[model samples]
Target: MAQHVERQRYWEAQQAARQAERLARKRARSIDWSAALRPVEPVPIRTETLIAALASGLIAALLLGDGVGPGLLIAAVPAVAAAYVAARAAGRRPRPWTLVWGVGSLALLVVPALRESAWPSTLAILAAIGLGALALFGSRTWPGVLLSPLGLLEAAPTGVRWAWQGVRARRTGNARNVWPVVKAAGVGIALLVVFGALFASADAAFADVLGGVVPDVSVSDGPVRVALFVLGVVVALAAARAAGAPLRWDRVTVAPGTPRSPVEWALPLVLLNLLFAGFIGVQLAVLFGGYGNVKERTGLLPAEYARQGFWQLLWATVLTLVVIALALRWAPRSGPRDRRLVRGVLGALCLLTLVVVASAVRRMDFYVHAFGLTRLRVSVVTMELWLGVVIVLIIAAGVFGARWLPRAVMASAGATVLALGLLSPDGMVAESNVGRYTEQGKIDLAYFQSLSADAVPALDRLPEPLRSCALRGINDDLADEGEVPWYGMSLGDRRAREILRERPVKASFETCAGLGTFRSRSEY
Candidate 1:
């Protein structure tokens, strides 16, 4: 009897192992990895696309080669125009809304010419252009928006290939037609040189005018300029090709996570909702009872209390978003009861998270009010506000379904960045700090000195010593900007130069040394 029992136990264990092996094989077979690995077909290069790309490249090389300035707008115009022409030539109707984004992108490039602040304007410009590219040539879906930058990277090699193909086509198939155009251009140049030299020699005033009007061509930076031109050509080719035949990123689908039972999904979210609700209750008490009550109860100053929780609250809000995304992915979708549970639990969490977002904003507001506004403070506030907008969109998605959520979120982000650029954050910060100085009779002169040319107008409004001290650094910078070319000129730099010329700072460093504190603590 003992031997028979042992045999039966061994057989049962072997059968269980075989069953587990079968299940693993089934799971492996279900995933079609080759579908993702399949190569996409290359887009055909067209004559119109090639010509527009080369023109755009030439424009970029000419205008943007000097440096970042108003030339950014000048360079972008041709590239955008090329994309538009390429789309039309391909017999495709370009989306009208994409034109709006394109206009917004061009408008954002104007920021660098308007504001001297590097970070905010640069960030806004890059974001706007990236979103605009995605809107024009990639998917409007969430995944597509997220992956659009990668598409640009992949297109880099394709651009090189496109250029090679154009060269090859000219060499083999169109070789007979190339020499006539080259010969004609050479003859025209020869004639112009013979007549122009005679005219210049014949008239001294004409020579001087010609010399002033034409730029002095130099070979000192030849390699650098050539490299920039090549880079511009490659980038233009990539963009034009993308516009002609956009990748179908919207069709790319990610499999859903393994579904959980209703009890398994709901319990943790319900508990999380309770936790969020409890924290919100504490926030309410602090809000209604005033900081004085908090000081009395907790023995902490308003700024101290506000500072201690602001960073933590910001992280918490960020983590809560990740949690919601994961929860939605793993949610049970078996029945009406499961759907109701998800809507209730997730909706409650979203509402509570909004309160948390509000609390974070309020905390930052309190901190900013106490310490005065800086660039970092202003940037953080803007980011927090945008995050709040994202949460609201998520809630809307929960109700109306999420098909439109991704594009809407992307659009909102682009709009928010454009708004930030338009607001001229550096000027706003300077204005706010100047107002604070008026009220409190305290100022951070060193901090003002570190600001860009955008702050010059606001700082000019100060009294004698404060005004001279704040303007001293900016004056020196403007003085060094002796002769900016038309393409490299910025509105902020021009305005700053004008302001300094009207009323220059006469104070030396030693004179304004001990006038104001730096207020380094205002950073956090």
Candidate 2:
């Protein structure tokens, strides 16, 4: 009986110990919601930091008021410089890679100064700024790069709060150095105004020169300028805070998906590889056999054949990437054999997808050759080329391991976009159409009318009524542009103005009326 009682006590003690451990684990796993929800304290603003932020805001308001052009780069300079200065002052040295990205971002602003097209310039600027933000505030991970834009949005409120804190501190007499600078600036401005006015009134030529040099400020632009100033201040403060204390996205861990058995993982991939292989074989046949073979087999014209499958093949390539990602996620990693299986199967899949990418690109090229290049054609071809690059990167990762894959992919994308901006898609399209017209005696003057000022030089090469019709819209736009400040003029805009000034479009409406209506039957 005593032995039974001891056993019962032992069992009870064991149960009690297990319960305590479970409780401890539960506590460990539970998040403190209140602490997470609490607002973060704003970093204290130094006098120099406040001054830099204000100056950046003022510069943005003045320069950016004219719109995106050289002024954009001019405004960005002070904002980026201020951020770097603030970071250094706070003892936070930026990484060399981050500085590289920052410089790239600044260089991207040149797109606006160089290109008149809205879409390309806008995309480049957004990408540039986003990359800069990611470098400064985001994690080094791929997901972090994508989500970094959210960090900028969140920083808006923080920036406002930081600016307000600075204002309050100044009101509380914490910034004694600021008052002296403000007084000195006021005195300097007053002296400049008095002397400048006297000199201007003293000479008519001097007055005219002064009027030409100074920008006209109107009350109507007050709201716009204020908004621009706020934007500049907010962006600068965000960069400063991010450089000082970046978000700890690197600390966020993603749990791997449940691992599958080797058979379960390998089977689907093997089938996919076989399918890709089959499609590639057919593509090879079509490629070597040429358009005659396509026409005979498909009973479709070369252009029709190209157009019919290009989009589908492009989607197939994209979906193949998605499939590869999923396969990687659930891939078996239990043993050496499984690892080798992964490498081999995924490697084959990537190789086959590259062929598919090539097929898609070829189809697009054939179509472009037949129908001439348009914006959509150029865009899709560029996308296909980038996808090919991504496939190559994936293959590299499979061989070398994937730790650097995400970053490499992002960098490649940025480089591709930068290249596209530099290449000038509109100019390329116009040039292609011109060449097609020269060879085939077929042109799409109406389509050319839709192009931006980037097309002017190429369109200027066209003969007679075609040239006049193609240039009409651009010429009208330039004519209405009036006298813009140099900062407001893009390279494309300036060049187009010069070209039109030298050889103006002189065709009447009646002459150009029926000219643009010529459309190829295969266009649809």
Candidate 3:
């Protein structure tokens, strides 16, 4: 009896030790990032890098040619990133991630230039660039992009320390000796203010004349603007550094589990699979019965028929992915049999989801074919296409977990964005609408009038009545071309200028919102 008791105690102690070890591992995996930011490294800044960074920022500011349009700001991303790369301490050949970032970042900047430099276009382009930068410089993945911001706190202190160290080293004086310089600056400021006020009081004409002076030549505002421009560039470069070279964060990988009953994940997945199959079967039936039957059965119009179930199917496709991922990550397995059953069920679900994806794509195509392609419609089409590719990849990964999957996906996404950039989506949209208008006499002049310069040449291909009004609208948009300097140039503006220069069409400038009008409506 004593022997048995001793053996039981030993087993219990062993289990306790295992539990403690697991807890220790968990604790080790999780870190208080806030605490470990100590002894942070100084931000690197070489003379060449500083010059490159400043030049890139200046180029961007200059490209703001029309005074800071979204296109110039966004397109500046790649230029800025290129500057960062030139400046980074590492002189080794660029990594794959960095190259992807470079391509994607530049593409993001050019997208706005290719399309209308609307606020939406600006936001989307910047977001894409930011994501690429985060992944490339920091985590090399989507989640890492999200966590990259937390790295700022560490960078902040280090940057300050580095700056302070530089000042201390350069000054060759006691730390407290800054008082003399501060006093001199304060006295100088007081003298300037006193003299300036007296001068203004003595001569009202002088003050009024100074106030009327152009900002470009204003003595008082020039120095301040220069200072502000320099400050802005510094901040931008600093942000790039923080994002690219952030301190490492703790990463925890879940441990593999022992064999267990299949009941945990099997039954639920089977039910889900059956539900997906039934849904897919219904979709197939509807697809086969034709749009007419769907229209009759659902009491929906042709337009409604095409639009119907799109959002639902999109959500379903996304949900299935999440479900499959969860099952793979957390599902209890009763060895190989349970694993196979789960994989088969998930695979079945994925295949069914592919049908849903197809249905969504078909609906989008029908809608675009009927309504003519808009930016939103084309974007959705692209999204659905990407989803289809993703589903196929997921299926393949399930069958065979290749280590190259993530890299392949990254490459494909980068390639797609680059291709889209080269293809010029705005130009394509214009081409599609013009073709549609050619076949059908119905053309929305106002909508066409609202399109960017890429559409102008396309609109020129239309018949006289449509062409006349459309050209008139475009001419009005470009009327202020003389006011904008060459530096603030845009593709749209350039194209419109070229066309106008070749054949100065006397377009009505009354109805169209000239490009300058957007400044009033700007959200920024």
Give each model's whole-structure lDDT: 0.75, 0.79, 0.59
Candidate 1 lDDT over 1-524, as tens digits, reads 99999999999999999999999987775544324422344345655566656666666565555556787777666667666765666665757557666776777787887777788678877876687577556466766778766666766677668668866888788877766766886899799888877888999998877655443436886666677667777776767656665665555667899998888888998899999999999988884366687677669876687888877887887888899899989999988888888888988988998898898888877777788888888887788788889889998998999987877887788788878877888789889989998998767787876778888889889988789998887777767766565566678877888888888897767778877523343454
Give candidate 1 misplaced runs (Cα > 4 Å): 1-44, 175-217, 288-294, 517-522
- Highest TM-score against the true fold, candidate: 2
Model 3 lDDT tens row, 312-337: 87888878777876777666664787
lDDT tens per residue, model 2, 1-524 = 99999999999999999999999876765543223322244357666666677777887787677767787887777667766765676566767767667877887888888888887888788878777776776456766767666776766677667768778978787567677888998999899999999999999999988876665668999999899898888877777666555555554455789999989999988998998889889888885477788888778877888888999988988998999889988999989988899999999999999998888888887788788998888888888999999999999988888887866786777777778888888999899999999999998777776688898999999998789888997887777778666677789888988899899998888777777533332334
Full candidate order by TM-score, most accurate first: 2, 1, 3
Candidate scoring better on TM-score of 1 and 2? 2
**Model 3 ranges off by over 4 Å:** 1-44, 65-93, 119-124, 135-138, 149-232, 243-245, 249-261, 288-301, 400-421, 471-474, 480-482, 500-524
- How far residue 495's Cα lies from its native spot in candidate 3, in Å, is 1.4
Query: Which model scores highest in lDDT?
Result: 2
